[model samples]
Target: VRPKFIDYYCPYTLGGHFINACNKDGEPVCGIYVKVSVERLNDISEQDAIAEGIDTDWLAESQDNYDCIADHNMSGRPTAKGHFSYLWQSIYGDDKSKCWEKNPWVWVIEFKRVQEQRND
Candidate 1:
């Protein structure tokens, strides 16, 4: 998923992270902001490792927060064998994590980009 801005401590170099307003420390740090949608929905099967597009169930569950649905489709976590990706989080510039202060249904997901995995 293309985030509005990237975090300085981003785990992945290819992709970026999301930082909340309060999460900023010291001074306001700039990030790599992107304005594109690369998120997709795919249906994969265990039979043949085939992937196809199907209706996303998460859409219905996204009524709580519209941004959640977009984040899910965009930065869904990557499995042991998957494609490029990133995670979304809300940092309100404080010791307490703002992202974690959401309902159980809502979540600030962790990004995992397989493309950046180390060969060693």
Candidate 2:
């Protein structure tokens, strides 16, 4: 088995300048709006081990819930809307605030197969 790498398109926007009532010019916006490409190593522990010339049995098993969150131990980033929190709250009755505080590391949204693979 080979390691199946997955790509995620993460759309993010930074805080932009606010409109000032006194200023006649439009609000000076100074922020970043961009998409980030995130990659995930597929559930191929045994394959990875074999390819790396290491013992396969010792590798840790992958979790069924494939999404990974950003937290202190992990990515350490805030959970954005329409990503992890939204899904968790909808499915598990887990609020975004609670998820963020409790298990931020695993509070990510899984990529839809079609969205991730982009198969036509």
Candidate 3:
């Protein structure tokens, strides 16, 4: 699966968390999470992964691009554009404690099929 930019956070050392936004079987699809350097972010493209056989459907539709600054040594303050300027703020507004800047990590959820039970 291909990774698409979902949002940005300050604490992340490299690129922010990405999610596979493809709707398959009418359900949201999830992709693998990869840590990439800022330089690499500019160098890589979804097309490259698609050419390499990774599904691009999920990536093409849900890519978000935003800049994040990390105040690793001190607590975070509201951004110039209000607290909702960043994706993190939009997701967890007023609840600054849950902001990604405070905890920079991405969770990639994977889904799999399972057999169903039948009458004997």
Highest TM-score against the true fold, candidate: 3
* Candidate 3 weakest ten by summed lDDT: 65-74
Q: After superposition, which runs of candidate 3 have C-alpha atoms over 4 Å from their true positions?
A: 1-85, 95-98, 104-106, 112-120
Candidate 1 per-residue lDDT, tens place, 93-118, comes to 22255332332232222333233323
The alpha-carbon deviation from the true structure for residue 27 of candidate 3, after best TM-score superposition, in angstroms, is 18
* Model 2 stretches with alpha carbons more than 4 Å out: 1-83, 95-97, 107-120
**Every candidate's lDDT:** 0.32, 0.33, 0.39
Residue-level error in angstroms, candidate 2, position 112: 13
Which residue window of length 10 is worst by lDDT in model 2?
107-116
Better of 1 and 3 by lDDT: 3
Tens digits of per-residue lDDT, candidate 3, 1-120, equal: 444674665364445655545554334354343543333212323444344344334323432322222422213432332212244455665454756345444332233433443459
TM-score of each: 0.15, 0.18, 0.20
For residues 2-116, could you state the per-residue lDDT of candidate 2 as single tens digits? 2223344324422352323322343322333343343332322334325434322322233422343322233433222213333445455544446433543222123323212
Local lDDT at 111 for model 3: 31
Model 3 residue 15 lDDT?
Answer: 56
Instruction: RMSD for all candidates, in order, please.
Output: 17.7, 19.5, 17.9
